[model samples]
Target: MDCNYIRGADLSHDSELNQKALAYHADPKPGKIAIRITKPFMTQSDLSLAYSPGVAAPCLEIRKNPDDVYRYTSKGNLVAVISNGTAVLGLGNLGALASKPVMEGKAILFKKFSDLDAYDIEVDETDIERFCDTVAAIAPTFGGINLEDIKAPECFEIERRLVERLDIPVMHDDQHGTAVISLAGIMNGCHITGRSMENLKVVIIGAGAAAISCARIYRFMGVKEIYMSDSKGLIHAGRNDLNPQKREFAASEGMTQKEAFENADVVVGLSAPGSFSLEEIALMAPNPIIFTLANPVPELFPEEVRAVRADAIIATGRSDYPNQVNNVLGFPFIFRGAMDVRAKTINMEMKVAASRALAALTQCEIPPYLEELYGTKLEFGKEYIIPKPFDKRLIVEVSASVAEAAVKSGVARIETFDLEAYRHTLAERLA
Candidate 1:
């Protein structure tokens, strides 16, 4: 008998990080997430109540009144992280099975950061209709659906169809998560520079999902002058070969790449590294806000940007840097609030509310522990424009803000919505 026997035990992968990651995933029971029973089943009575006799009572009650399902089951706290592997991180289209690890990681974040139970659903279909239908079919199983990592244009339609068809919260985290967090930083940056949202001229280096969503959310924040560039450069009226999403953000007068970046107040990079030249980024106005958000590699690094223009405020997707516009700062808590309020949809109002809530947290007194944890003094400055993901107050403040917006926007489904009481309940999750 072999003591260390396991499937593919002899097989190995290359690189130091690969080995460490492989062993970490394999030795930790093959996955990053697992489900746990919230109910007791220690005896025959417990079994009868959990399954056979007592379970029937809640089932009948739910059948009699459809909304009773939220009262009787875990659906109110459960979110499905659904994805098609078309655009899984920086590694594109690795297919459904390959995206499982990412989905599981997302589920774990949902649990650890916001106390939400999540199941990762990797759909094997890419056809927009089939994908949407599959997600819609399983929609009833979750209180909310977080659409993830599907390629753009298609993801837009998929989310649209599901949000229209289902009576639950639906959000494409790839789209709105970055949007929400980035907007928070933008809000703080503008305040620091004394720039008004309506007067800001924004240039986006990618026309993908996140960039489009950022443009949409910034519009809600009253940012009017937005120019987006795909692989073809600035999305402008002269381009006959533009998709609807790209066309919507197009500038009426086609401008040169230099013209687009020149005097721009903000620039966001959602594409790969070197998506724009240093000279291009250098063309921005004085004290410009630059977010090079491409993961693993940004369009331009902080040092590079600083060398060219020291006054420019910079943000990246990397955690090692200051003012990281991470999605973790948005999704879990956003869903937590939305589900608690039984929101019909995660509307623009809720998103803007969450962004403002996050921006506000940076100005609040920093927790003593965070300064010690990060080995740096944290405050509302150029270096600390957004709250850290581990901040205990996030689940309380962000969730409460989203809930209030949900209620005020007329999207909440529950009766007697109490914002103060809901804030208390959310705070207990940290306690």
Candidate 2:
């Protein structure tokens, strides 16, 4: 196949997809989501109950107990999708107003995937203290907070401050969402390739927010020897220009991209397209786990990887591929589980549980209904190490695991938890 022909076809397809997306968001109103009244409002009696005299009853009760706010209102099921627009998906520093569409899109996914209610809140403040203050002031309105599209370094500080100040589940989806989903796929890849987590050598091809988070999660999963790279080169302790976040993942030794890939068990590409060459990838161990998760264009294409090493387990951020370690597979279910338990925070335990749950799910018997949805037979293998985003069992398995983890970790406010019973409820949400 001619490379130019493929590039031309991809360009035309992208143009058509973008046009359709614009039309879809425009015709149905100027947004991808909207509020819907869930209660009766036709009669004067209903109006009174919805507000004024009758509403004061629940308000008074909530004021007395404080915790009764969850019982009286929708706070326990509501999440705020927040952003300052500095890192709007591939389009950087577009400002708050421009990130509304992406934020709204996040809210809708929460509703569609997990039966949670969400609102998009775009903060105009860029200063770290001001941004955190604004979000904390409005934090009471939601059971959880999803920080999105804010640039790194600032994002780290904002999330840290807000997490300490608020008593709800808080997550920066760009970091932890990518972490959980990719970790799940990598876990399965390790299982199938006869590799153990502790012994594996990892070369992460970016040192940005997502890349840093991925390194942390890999560490939690018992992976040592994680070598990360930034714009300059491999992140080693000798480098003087490293950010605080990048410095955390610094290796004791420096190596070329080629030397780093030599016998490496896994390589995660979260940087820009062509960040590393295919020749470097060919230096990896047999049956290497290759996750090139850069959106729109990966650091290395699946085809390009396959041409070099046929034993490699491949995944990309794109849905058109077999193993897509996409964030949509993580956030909704994670928040669903956390909010259900009234978790005070989305701790690393919950995140690790969610990723392990996803890995276990991939090896489960694929239901006929699920296979029918994608028009294919699904199985656990190198090609299908990650569960498809459309798999319905995610709500049950992943959510239950997250909730259980929250309870066990002592972050959940709920008095008691029944794992099986909770799984049943999650399944009912889908039904």
Candidate 3:
């Protein structure tokens, strides 16, 4: 694949590319994923074992000890990519049926990137309590639940209740996936810019799920002062209409977006396109780290940022650009590790471990084949603040770190863990 052609391919007005994308989805198969039997079903004995008296033995074993389900069935390796379709990528609330493509795409990523089986499940309910109840009721079938594209306020509550109600690891990927991947970039960007987290003044635009989650995670990483804003303007202490989730990130006083950007050490954008101008980018402090990570488009294009402030280290959510803060780099492997150890939940320690693992991978020597494939040199600098999504080392490194953290944090059900053997197991699964 030619990098320039990929970067320059404009699908918005290109009828040919649009048709190709549609045909790619519609042809050969109706969807991007399908189920295949892992065990033999060709003989009479195979049928007996798969569906009849022989299967009853394992069922009885699972009844005697529920943990035996992991030993006798595929439940341990399966994940449910559940979504209410309230917030489908950059498209916004396209409804359950319309969100199928993105959900299926997510399932494909789980299989392709992490060698895990995922089923895309779109639940057609908007009421928060009903949604949470529905997911919790069905949670026992899978090792983990990946909540996707549920809208804010409700998403926060849904995730909280699900995490508390169910023992299996549950995560709202739209919220924490962006946070984890962006935090990795921030870690390396801060390193390159010679700034410490505690001293940095951060500005986050868009107080939706991703924005609020990023603010919280950055604070956990020792960032003290953070300014955030939504479409209604700055989230501040004086705002009477703020929800509890938004209130957690409210600034001291309401400030205009321009005021929020002034002298900031880092600025993160999760809002709409053209939300920030070059003038806003120029207002940041020297050697600023800017992550304008809106999909399809960003707050400010990389070219616009570079033309205004050459000293800034910029990233976006587009693969064509350098430092793409993609969630694909986080969730698949995060869940892989969580399921590998039968983790009770994805805790703060596991999340931080994954982030640090990603940051560390970026600093390692890039493989020559990866450079040739991506048509760029991969070194730790302004352009390479995080690992590429295609880097095969991700499943081995990030997943192992997360699994180790799960064990150390007392969240793993397994009594013993071998880190070296686990890495080889992860590699062989991909192979």
Two-way lDDT contest, 2 vs 3, winner: 3
- Tens-digit lDDT track of model 2 for 32-91: 887888899999999999998899999989888999998888998999999998877655
Model 3 residue runs over 4 Å out of place are 1-17
TM-score of each: 0.95, 0.95, 0.95
Query: What is the Cα-based TM-score of model 3?
Result: 0.95
Error of model 3, residue 198, in angstroms? 1.0
Give the 10-residue window scoring lowest on summed lDDT in candidate 1. 1-10
CA-lDDT, candidates in order: 0.88, 0.88, 0.88
Candidate 1, residues 362-383, lDDT tens digits: the string is 8999989989989998878888
Give the per-residue lDDT of model 3 (tens digit) for 153-183: 7889899999999999999998999999999
